[model samples]
Target: MAHIIMIHGSWSGGWMWDRVIPILTAAGHSAEAPTLLGADPGGSRFPSRPLTAWADQIAARVREAKGPVVLVGQSRGGLVISEVAERVPERVGYLVYAGAFLLPDGASLGGTIQSAHPGAEPIFSVDTATGMTTVLPEALERIYSKTPVRWIEYARAMQCLEPLAAITTPISVSDERFGSVPRAYIEATEDQVMPLSLQRAMQARLPCNPVFAIESDHVLPSSAPEELARHLVEIANRVDHPARLRRPVL
Candidate 1:
């Protein structure tokens, strides 16, 4: 069974994965969805942290795992997971991007998003006085209309600002170390936040093609946990099955 490290996107804590974790555990896989710094509602009451700090948190988890782990990143969390893979590729079994933001070397997450799709609204808005940033609730309607209403409400309630500047900075991963690890991407067909065209475009940037697609919105793991879990399991099974040198055509 593969050990998995799950990360949630902007304005969300690990709670976002609550629905999906059970499906993975029931299937005999071990997974951990730790809230990012400044994200956990009940954790330490410290000041907000930076993106690399969040990436460092995940790296620590990867280092502590008993064996190689599959890193699952959703939305902005995808950026963090990729950075972790770049830094500690030897400990990572696979890098799974779920409606994730995939960046090239030396690219900042914000800059990459701006370059990839111009005219998109900032996912996080900042308040200079307190140095806190929060995601706008209106954006959720655009991003997660297909998602359950309650889940959206919960996400909005937990919407805290991340250090946007810090998150956008480029990070490094050794090519010799991480280049060969298996990778998977899950496309949310109805995702308005990251459109299907963008999702396909992001998948194209990956070294290998992704293994599955769910015709739901951005919150597929919460909206359709069982289905998402099934796809994840399929990708996990392919760990032993040799990867096809050629990419699969959707």
Candidate 2:
């Protein structure tokens, strides 16, 4: 059994991992989903908090874990986990990026997204005054279109503003530390929020072994919870018990 940490992306909290957490727990693995600072609802908002703060929050969680953890990050949370792995690589068993931004050193999330879509901003609504960004209601349709309507509603209700600085700040990860850790990437072929082409492009730059593809939207946790959970378990099993690596992929 491996300790798993689920880190959600921008405008989302630990609640996003609700489905997968139960599945992992049932399998007798320890799993935790931590809401990144400023992403939690009904809490103090700090728009100026840098991306390093988000990474530090996760690193702290990793430090508290019983053993090396399988860190799974979705969307913008990928950046946070990447930094966490860099800060405490010894504590991370594997770094999994599920339809996430696996950026290289010295890259910023905002710049990468801007480059991918150019002038087309499909989901985010930035508030310059508060230096925060929130997801547009209409974008929910794009994000969780494959998910049930009730799940979509729940996600919309839980949405919160994310600090703009967290996305704008570039991160520095060393090859000596972050690179030494094993990594995996899950490609959401039908993702609307982050285009499939962009997802493939990011993975091309930071290649991960045993890349898995799923026919789901950006919100895999809600859209394909069982499938996502199975994939995570497969990765964990392969990492923890090498004998399972030879098992046929489902």
Candidate 3:
């Protein structure tokens, strides 16, 4: 079984993976889902820190794995994985992006979103004293058509957003490190935050043709856990034995 590390995006924490973790573990794979820094919305004890600091935390998790891990990033966690891969590509076998950011060189989270669709509100807002940005309720409400009541409660619980300044800074990536690593992109067909066209466009930048489409919304793990689990397991199995090709033959 592959060791998988799951990273949550802005305004969310490790709790976001609660539904999927059981599935992965029951299937015999060891899985970890860590909340990013400044994203503990529920009064959890998370040290307020920068994006790079969060990347470092993930790298530490990767280092503790038994073997090379399958790093999975959701939403802005995509940016976290990109940075982690650069730091420890040897420890990462496959980078699985679930409706996450797959940015070009020298792009920040803010810049990437702005470049594609301008005048959008930042994914999060800040707490001046803590310098932590929490997710804006209005944004979440707008993104989800009928977000579960529990999720809204969770959002209320752990609602810190990333600071705009940190989000706008270009993340450092070396082509030498990120170029050779295998990549998988799970594009959400009905995603409101990330347009399908943009996901397709990002595919062009990956090293290999990623798993292109998953019929769901931005919140795949929550909205369609079983279907998402199937795709994730398939990708894990494919990485284990590259010779055993699973892509549908047209």
Q: Which candidate comes out best when scored by lDDT? A: 2
TM-score of model 1 relative to the true fold? Answer: 0.87
Candidate 1 residue lDDT tens string, 1-250:
7787889987677888888888887887788899887767764542344666777888999899875588888888777887887678778777888877766567676676677679887656777875556667667787677778887777777665565555556755555555556678888888877787877776676644555778888777666777888877666555434453233332
Compute each candidate's TM-score over C-alphas.
0.87, 0.93, 0.86
Best by TM-score: 2
lDDT of 3 by residue, 177-249 (tens): 7655678888888887887777777776653345767766676776667777777787777666766533321
Candidate numbers sorted by lDDT from highest down: 2, 3, 1
Give per-residue CA lDDT, model 2, range 123-188, as digits (tens). Answer: 878889977788888888988879899999898888888777877889789888888778888988
Q: Which stretches of candidate 1 lie over 4 Å from their true place?
A: 43-49, 240-250
lDDT of 2 at 44: 65
Q: What lDDT would each prediction earn against the true structure?
A: 0.73, 0.84, 0.73
Tell me how candidate 2 scores on lDDT.
0.84
1 or 2: which has the higher TM-score? 2
Better of 2 and 3 by TM-score: 2
Evaluated at residue 98, the lDDT of candidate 2 is 91
lDDT score for residue 235 of model 2: 86
Q: What's every prediction's RMSD, in angstroms?
A: 3.1, 3.2, 3.6
Candidate 3 error regions (>4 Å): 41-49, 121-123, 126-131, 146-149, 242-250
